[model samples]
Target: MSEIISDLNTIDKESIRIAKKYKQKNKNAAGSKEGTFTKIAFISISLIFVVLMLVVPLISVVINSLKLGLAFYIESITTEYVISAIRITLLATVIAVIVNTFFGIVASWAITRFNFKGKQILTTLIDIPFSVSPVIAGLSYIMTFGRMGWATPILDTINEALGTDIQIAFAVPGVVLATIFVTFPFVSRELIPVLNAVGTDEEQAAALMGAGGLTIFRRITFPHIKWALLYGIILCTARALGEFGAVNALSKTRGGTFTLPLEIDALYLSGSADSITASFAVSSILVIISVIVLILRNIVEYKVKK
Candidate 1:
């Protein structure tokens, strides 16, 4: 028992000695790292700028939204025009998100899984909306579907033959189409890296194990990319809800087409503080929805990481 006690004492002393040596070494290394200090300083300053850019405007929006009285805010929300604007924007945002989610998933699959002629060109083409001006994007639709458009005659013939009218660049279809165009790349862009990380080997292995394509997708591919896919869709939906230029131009804004942005613009034109406050009331609703969606996104990511 005495010998065992002596052995433990020796081991404890040796461990303490090693720990002291390691601490000295780490302290010396940290003291020598001027470059590391500079890097941390730079990163801190850059982060300050980033926070200022992102958070300041959001704070301003919230403050402005609260400038009105409670009754005024309630009345603004209850107005029929404001209610319609909210509904239309919500409807367009939801439909656009649904459509874009499918496009992104399928396009990502096609782009990564297949090789075809003009594949590179087609990939570049997907980014056309990002490069082109939003106003021009809207104009292109107008020029294709308006009375003076080339397709107008084709549409006229179809209308004559079928006795049914189809409006492509107006109303709900126009809003949804414009949104889909703007948001098409998000899901594809997100899923590409995830799919690439997963590699093709898993899918191939699953296939060899007698798993069908859909089964492989469900059991293997979906789990891998689901988080990124959802993140991209949330971002796309947010952008779609706030879209102004493309929607307004394509919609013509003549026959009962008033999205939230358009409605806000109309309020500004009226030159009344109350109208602008009404607009802010509507904007506040969007801000709330965006905040909730972003929160949900973070929660999803946390669950995924865990």
Candidate 2:
């Protein structure tokens, strides 16, 4: 009789354990359903936001651009003024990208590789363009290089010596300068964190191995940062292309110094239906360029991750 009682007790404990496990699993299943619902809700909200803000505006621009028919749209973007604007915009973007890339590389290298006085100050100064408004930057350049400004005499002396009537304020050079000032920090900012993450140990080791500075950089540093640098260049190019306030402040000559953004503004401000349509047409060009740059940026980002 005692053996039968022991067997009964064992069977009862096993049944109780199985019941507890089933209860715990049901609780977890309930929690999992709630979690899945929350995730889906967040994703839906994000998709709605992107569709409303970005997709809608882009589609609207495209529709308006072709509203006047494809021939009219082509004519609007092919005008002499439009062509000049395109040329100037491309020129400024190219110059800004080249100059900033060089400066960014040098600045990033100095900041990452060395301990020096005013290093923090130098880093802060590099970021000035990001904090400062483009309009303010344009005005500052005007004040510095305008006829009555302090630097005017020096500029005049150089112009006289060079036998060239080169103009900065209210000219092509000024537009380029403004573009450079606004897009200055993109490359450096992109590179700094990357260099920091890479650390200096490898570079120091290569130096100890009697590798020349260039060799060390080319073999070790450049490989790591090339994608970052390309990413920065793409960003710089995009910013340069869209820059308006600074370029507008420096350049008032419509056909000579206007970029695509300025041309679009001029067309819109004319207050005619045709001009308004033309403005949208010009805007479509920028939209296309921006899409291309964005695609390139994503590709570079993917490469960086890989």
TM-score of each: 0.81, 0.93
Tell me the lDDT of model 2 at 58.
88
lDDT tens readout by residue for model 1, 1-306? 999999999999999999999999999898779768989999999999988998777777667766787788788767777777777778888888888788888888888776788978878888788887778877887788776689888988998999988777676677777777777787787787778777888888988889998898899899988888888887888888888888888764622567888877787678888887777776777788888888988886786565
Q: Where does candidate 1 have its weakest 10-residue lDDT segment? A: 250-259
lDDT of 2 at 123: 92
Best by lDDT: 2
- Tens digits of per-residue lDDT, candidate 2, 1-306, equal 999999999999999999999999999999999999999999999999999999999888889999999999999999999999999999999999999999999999999999999999999999999999899999998998886668888989998999988889889999999999999999999999999999999999999999998999899999999999999999999999999999988899999999999999999999999999999999999999899998999999999878
Q: Give the clashing pairs for model 1.
A: none
Per-residue error at 23 for model 1, in Å?
A: 17
lDDT of each: 0.80, 0.95
Residue 56 error, candidate 2, Å: 0.8
How many steric overlaps does candidate 2 have? 0
